[model samples]
Target: MQKRSVILAYILWLFLGQLGIHRFYTGRTGSGIIQLILGAAGWATTGILIGWFPLFVLWIWLVIDIFLIPGMCRNPE
Candidate 1:
């Protein structure tokens, strides 16, 4: 059985998603950085209501990520 990163990622997504913490937890450093920047910029520039769209997308992305992280974590030998 493979060790899954999904649960951890989901938790981060649920809580620290605006900081892109979930992406970092999932080993997607580049995307994490991007999300962090976008999220921050959006919040700073537009406030929560306008910034929410990307956050919503991130939420959906996190949900989808739950199915993917486990597979990506599968050990190959």
Candidate 2:
């Protein structure tokens, strides 16, 4: 398996993490798609308070991913 870079992953996470672009770059397509959908839908439904939950969760997840990303790189598929 090809090894991913921690630095690139951090950069992606810093910039595009909100839309799950960092997950995609890290070879987590499933997570990326889920985040993408949630982010898009969250923006679309912003008029209601319910939409903020997913975005909030995603933000927390992304922040946690800062530590998790190195592990992901260590065990790539």
Predicted model with the maximum TM-score: 2
RMSD, one per candidate, in order? 4.1, 1.2
Error of 1 at 9 (Å): 1.1
Q: Model 2 clash pairs?
A: none
C-alpha lDDT values of all predictions:
0.68, 0.84
lDDT of 2 by residue, 1-77 (tens): 78889998888888888888878877888988998998888888879888899888887888899898898777765
Q: Per-residue lDDT for 1-77 in model 1, tens only? A: 43546667567777887787866765668878987887777677565477777667766766686676565445311
lDDT of 1 at 26: 59
Which lDDT value does model 2 have at 25? 76
- In angstroms, how far off is 16's CA in candidate 1? 0.9
Off by over 4 Å in 1: 1-4, 47-77
